[model samples]
Target chain A: MKYYNWGIIGLGEIATSFTNSFQQENSQITAVASRTLSKAVAFANEHDIPKAYGSFEALLADQAIDIVYIAVPNRQHIEHILKALAAGKHVLCEKAITMNSAELTQAMTLAEEKGLILAEAMTIFNMPLYQELRSQIDSNRFGKLKMIQAPFGSYKEPDPSNRFFNPDLAGGALLDIGTYAVSFARWFFTSQPKVIASVMQPFSTGVDEQSATILQNDVQEMATVSLSFQAKMPKQGVVAFEDAYIVINEYPRADEAKIFFNDGTVETIVSGDSTQALNYEITNMIKMIEGETSNRSLFLTKDVIDLLDQMQQNWTN
Target chain B: MKYYNWGIIGLGEIATSFTNSFQQENSQITAVASRTLSKAVAFANEHDIPKAYGSFEALLADQAIDIVYIAVPNRQHIEHILKALAAGKHVLCEKAITMNSAELTQAMTLAEEKGLILAEAMTIFNMPLYQELRSQIDSNRFGKLKMIQAPFGSYKEPDPSNRFFNPDLAGGALLDIGTYAVSFARWFFTSQPKVIASVMQPFSTGVDEQSATILQNDVQEMATVSLSFQAKMPKQGVVAFEDAYIVINEYPRADEAKIFFNDGTVETIVSGDSTQALNYEITNMIKMIEGETSNRSLFLTKDVIDLLDQMQQNWTN
Candidate 1:
């Protein structure tokens, strides 16, 4: 079997992006599977993959497929994650990883029991700019880490049948976009933070269309996160300090940040290319599987899922 | 007496900014006052004023003063406002117009009873661009108002004895910078919105150092306001709609906005001068006193204060 052997279990838009990104530097797409044989064959032919399977189980049974990239819809994450892990293949699923902490814990436990790797394909956990900023923060280059603001908004049509507002699809701003905002926040806080307060405006389908949440870490460093589905807000992230602040515009895939100091000097910091965001996630997943790095990003992802769970729980009242 | 005679009840930095701003167009400053006679006399000489008062009482007794601009500290706003209104002069008090809604209501009622005009020096209610934006919204220019964001932050030293953290002076982020943030949000909302959620970080002196509040209007339009006293946040405000959104940088004194449409068209809107933000407040106050404009700004100020009161009350619990 070739090193870094990979198979895709879904042929959606996200799956195409993943296949293209992973193939940019290395070609290890051993096979691809879709519910329909024609669709899988078409995708595999277009991507020049070695094989295509009509059933996910057939691809999982392939001895050459050591890892499975689960690109299915949100509602199918846990089932696919467990199936791939139980089939002795490492799993890297798209965000959000699961519906709640319970589901995530079950999957995590199964992966641990099987001695297999499992991670959420949250770009926030893999972005090189965040990793660079995290080290700068730890090095005390700026003063105390005090405040962070993460705002993400994407305009989606109000049609109730649309996937953005469809309740059966686990559709809402929270799972769709709030995961990134919360993950960005969780990565900055010193420790796990609690959801101090949360409020949401629900769509006609009883899903959160827009929401605001406040989080405070044990050290009193607070974070404010705002999300919306009907408006386009700038994806600006601010990490403020006592004597300076770091601002990253279009922060989700940002490779640059401007640091404004109280002493009237501004410094700009740059990291890896933003266009390679997906490739960065794939590279990091490979490193974790190869035992080259610790699974800290997975821990942060777990905390973020917990935060999303609590925020949703809060809205139920 | 001049048609628009004005007297200032404080000799602080804000009072100086007010003097400079009001003089840019027309010179109507009739007198100046300070508790110290020498300070008052120096201020009068520097500004070329006709009279100076050693005490606030002496300024209220000046028959030539038809209006009073109270620029005292936050804790002293109510006292000077009441004194100015009771002396039969129209009052324009610095924001955080009063300690609480009760105090503001008392002053508002007294002003109504005494037939004197009273208004807060909140530039948000008087800025021409906001008025222009409001009319545009009324004209259905941008499908529907969905979200508004107002964030303000000003860093101060962590000294507990400093006025920014002193409880005796009613010094806090809420009264100081939050007034601007909240006022910006309140001006855009269709109706009075309740504080759905609030969280704050207190300073060593027990005054709020930073805070976040979520508000939802009657039409389900949502707003997010964040404030800080120990960090500098961009005073950028966002007014988002269904198909387009307006962004104003340095929004507290903004005279321009950039409208971004979904179809990739960008339009710039400009009105008035930012340098004359305080002058706009002065001009609008004069218009209200002259029976040309209604006391709508004052009503907005009252609503903003009520929201601030509720946020503070939440912190105590």
Candidate 2:
């Protein structure tokens, strides 16, 4: 099997978590970059990464890195992903993919021109548990799918300096956690629902502290999602059907899930967390580079980016 | 002081709770009515009400009853309130005062013509706790209000037969619990905020099981609210100001609440709950009839009903 060397941008909490998960999965972290040299050096030392570079440019210039995972803030994802695509490296970008879909399309054009694989790191999509749930629904085990309800939120002190609460950082609950819930709804429902109405609370720093979104598709299929940074919430997803229901515990963040049927039958699907979804995308990119596939089919990273952009524009307008 | 003898329409859970509370507050439940004479007789006998009627029309036609509390389902609120208003009795309707706001307006106009008080039973507005919190915010104790977040949800089995999951009954989170959260936001902000965005999940019966809403005023003040019948949630409200936050426990429902300040100070405010907020309106109606006031102001029933109408239209559109 061919191995893909990875370069990571942005040495933040998520970056560290991805690095640790990648290492545990036996994936190579070939290079690491940060805005500051000292921080990069410290992260490299802690993670046993082969190379640490102070500048993104230097890391992009390196020929050994086969894939670059853009783990930076929302605004930076576009620039960094474009640069990585320009440098002939497959790119795995974080969620919200870009500040908007237009930026995402620009990056996609560049990636397409270079014959490079570009995917968004939406971890839940690649999990075996979700796949199994999808299969069950497709098989009509839960009868006709009716609704999906999910809430992903936490009670955290408001800190304007943090990227999660900084408007300039493209921060808000919708772009952060809401993406997961919305994506799950779209993925399960297999259609983009119209944003029917919304209510949001802006923090002191002008970022959404909590948001409630309601969407409905042409078939009248509806999904309700709540994302918050101001309260404690159950990190779960519920799929309600005509005959039965599927409950995903810690969905969008859980590797394993339980399925409940209308007949009082319960089945637990355990998909070991073998890799942080970022690393899985890296593996997929390696497969694509080795002539297996050309683009992402399940997530359609570009389409998701477009959908997010549309949602944000709708909210702002 | 002049006292108003009260008649209750629909002797269900809410009506029983209201009459029980009213009795404790020195209010008289002189008449009770339901579609079934047995139900009304049973309720009246249990509560020591002097009169039990088989139908709502009979109760409304009674000249001795000065006020009527319409505690029927959402679809029936308008009909019952209008009937009571047409009978020249003051009416205190339950939340989501009508199936939509148009019905509320018609009832309000009829009440005005009859010179009768037509108010909504939004007991939270009458609670001393909310009043105290409002006073603190008005006094600039928490600085300028920036955000408001509240999530109110409960987990229940999805049985199409249940009123909460039955579309024919106008069942949905938005019309039920969501209205409370929306009303709380409007009450706090005291302005009509645009519904920026919304997402919802419809139950098998075609009613919304869960809904998330975001609203923003022209000044950019925002509030996010989530309502669900699919999960358990903290029935509380959080008001984030420029310098501090006031956290209210079990807001929009409970009489007593704990307020948490940003500076780590905590205080508790307790208010009368004998009538589940129904007695407060009853007391106010008596005062109004006695020339103490010409109309209800504490709850601003008109504004709330209007807001609900606008929000429901926004969702449908």
Give Cα-based local distance difference scores for all models: 0.89, 0.72
Stretches > 4 Å off in candidate 1: A24-27, B24-27
The superposed Cα distance between candidate 2 and the true structure at residue A241, in angstroms, equals 5.7
lDDT of 1 by residue, B145-233 (tens): 88888888888988889888999989899998999899988888889999888889888889999988888877888888888888887
* lDDT (Cα, 0-100) at A72 in candidate 2: 87
Per-residue CA lDDT of candidate 1, range A48-121, in tens?
99899999999999988888999888999999999999999999899999988999999999999999899999
Cα lDDT tens digits for candidate 2, B1-317: 55568898887788867776673344577898999999999998998889999999999889999888888888988878877888889887777788766787788788779888777777666665566667766787665555667667666687998888888888877778877787788767846676666656667887877766667677656676767676555566766655555556677766665655545577776766623566666666676666776664534656666655665665577
**Lowest-scoring 10 consecutive residues by lDDT in candidate 1 chain A?**
A19-28
What fraction of the genuine interface contacts, i.e. the true contacts, does candidate 2 reproduce? 0.15
Q: What is the TM-score of chain A alone in each candidate?
A: 0.97, 0.90
